[model samples]
Target: MGLSHRSAQSHDHWFVTERDELHRSDAIELNGRSALNAAGIDIDDVVYLDLYSCFPSAVQVAVNALGLPLLDPDRPLTVTGGLTFGGGPGNNYGTHALATMTETLRKDPGAVGMVTSNGMFLTKHAVALYSTTPPRDEFRVTSPQLAVNARPRRVPTEHYSGTVQLETFTVRHDQQGLPERAIIVGRTGDGARTWSRSSDQGLMAALETEDLLGHSMRMADGHVEEISAVSREGLF
Candidate 1:
């Protein structure tokens, strides 16, 4: 239908700032639906899909934004099993997806396929639809930045010392497969966003096994003071 960009990213944070109710990038859904609608199609009309997947989180965000079912047996999210599984040619995931979509469309004769692209911490996004059938309209790129920029933004806070509710987080493991560190994003009572990192073994372990979204915690100056009281007192 159409191709588009989200505009320049935030200077303080690398991740997308324009998020929807679910905290997924508004640009991802906007461009995906715009492309489908412009092509005179809809989600029902698409048979093949490849969502950008440099990480599982990216795929999940796109899936949620596009309202795709998380457990659909008929529609596999990726034609190549995604970048983590499909093999990443560095930053050329979109081209890989396009090549795979073309090959898949060739086999299916006329089925339509969609591929989503991402850049720099999911800050930039583009969507494209393809098929064996020829195009009826000329190609072009689109932008929904004006709409995106109008959405509510969570200002990044550098120094914070108080209670917070976890917005999102990721835990990293060491070479030995043990919990090593965690990168966390949380919001204060006033809704400002703050990011912090912690290498506490207990904290990282707890994060891996639990759903921490909305969990309360304490942070000081871009650091997780302690997670020892997490389960009992909700501070990490």
Candidate 2:
């Protein structure tokens, strides 16, 4: 078994994200491929997968990072259905995945399994590998903050007054499953990212059905204008 825990250093999840960062995950501290590499294991040798799937994006990130198709009958992403079909157990979800991996490996000798877990807006990452056969070398546990911290991190612009491109956002719903607010991340003309929020009912409604990315958002002195005129306000 091998385990690698990593950090992006910044607490803000969107500090270095882009429109496709959720899938590409290049800015993430460590991915399953790298973790497997450090363990002297080839990704092609793995036979089981248990990627963290608290959300579809989490699995998408893993799929992109590990070079996998989103849905494959021969190679489903998880031994267990993950948090989607099963209830999320917070960080403890990995325990259920590991137990499933054990059962899977036991069913077929010499099979390999991999598990990936993340939390807190992708700021933290953990990857583990298991094999029915003994590893060629000892498992290495690493927390390489120094290497990760060396990567350049973008600082959020404190103020902006220009046309912003809506990059990505998520609508937060209430107990009744109604969208009450939306969190947004938009990029300036020069590509710097900023965070904002909106509670406009009409806009929130449209966000659920609209492809709002690349829509215009005018911000000046902490005031935000909407996308496609469907929205009229936002907060930083």
Candidate 3:
């Protein structure tokens, strides 16, 4: 199944779900729910459940759906070394968690170990469990009811239908006193899908000198680059 992690902003989320017309998040939630359903895990079988913990939202959504309380004071919150502790490598690093749990179960025998994997900036999620002995506890996490009930409502309806062609994209220069941000330049579209164009003196000047985030920019072609205009509407 596909997966996605959207930013917390309403605009950014709309770009992906509405403008891009992607349903990756919906597919991922369904896939997870299907796996739990097929396993026949009841509340009793679930000794513990650890949702992917990369960011706070992931854990919050899962607990709310499964009706699990937040961390218990008596129980240690972390069972494995966190990412900060070098628990694993990037996306695929979660494989390392499997290796760690294998040894932990071997020694504990009847004890259980749980690990959660977060992919693509919390866009995807995974939960794994291990026990030297056959599991006597049941799995009770229900279908992703929270997501199903709350569907996406806002998305970009219009693409940059304007006549814009991407000519080139430039990473911020790191020369002696160069700016510390990336920049792109191309032709402006007719206002259809998102488009880019050459940087004008006005835009180039800002990128070359100013500090801005999530704004629209255009560069004018001339003897020297000129920034045409800047938008503060939070377009990154």
Candidate 4:
């Protein structure tokens, strides 16, 4: 399947419209159920469904999109400790989820759990089922023959303009392996773009004192120029 979040205002409308048409309900349950149905599967066979919740919106969209009962005292959602409490470690976090679900299923052999992985700033999705008595489910393995050609969506590439969300970004380190500069993946009214600012002094300062992760830096002209400089490698 596909796990995607509303990152672009343009895509949001398309997503909702298409999702409702395909699923028949603007709800997470319906979306999940619809996918299973598309594959000609039944929901009763699904013993568990874990809403891939990273942000509040994800949870909200699932609830609204699927026509699921808001308050189900019996079916309490959420398996992996919420994203805030339990770190959303990039790609491999879901691997942990699979292992955890495997153990859970091992304990209760008949139980089936659906594990969904949301990747790339919630831009993609994948769902897998776990059961002790498996090998019965038919599968269409994704293959290169599918011939999927993905190109970055059309983004406005004029002089720096428009507003964009910062998905996940990082700083690059120099030869000595020190944080030398920061490169950010930003989305504008157009699409996703990359920007970086380099200054050994500024980076040294941030490294020596402040932890740079999750720090926001605006794009002005081009580079995120540093103001104060201490030494070439060190910062004031």
Candidate of highest lDDT:
1
- What lDDT tens digits, residue by residue, belong to model 2 across residues 1-236? 32222212212234445323433454333445456667666667777888888888878876876677788888788998887775555568878887878888888877777777777776567667776677666656555445455554544675677778776788999999989888877777665777777888887887789777767887775446667654423412
Q: Write the per-residue lDDT of candidate 3 for residues 37-67, one digit (tens) a residue.
A: 4443432343433345565665555455344
Q: What is the lDDT of residue 4 in candidate 3?
A: 16
The CA lDDT at 53 in model 4 is 68
Who is ahead in lDDT, 1 or 4? 1
Tens-digit lDDT string for candidate 4 (117-160): 55433334454555676444444322111111121233333335
lDDT of each: 0.72, 0.67, 0.41, 0.45
Candidate 4 scores a C-alpha RMSD against the true structure in Å of: 12.1
lDDT of 1 by residue, 1-236 (tens): 22221111121123443242334777777777667767777788889889888878888988987789877889999999889778877787777887887888888876888888877767777777787776566655566566666666776787789888777788888799887889888777877778788988778877888766677788887787754334433323
List candidate 4 stretches off by more than 4 Å. 1-35, 38-40, 141-236
- The TM-score of predicted model 1 comes to 0.79
Q: What is the lDDT of candidate 4?
A: 0.45
TM agreement with the true structure for every prediction: 0.79, 0.79, 0.42, 0.43
Better of 2 and 3 by TM-score: 2
Q: Which residue pairs collide in model 1, if any?
A: 1-39, 2-35
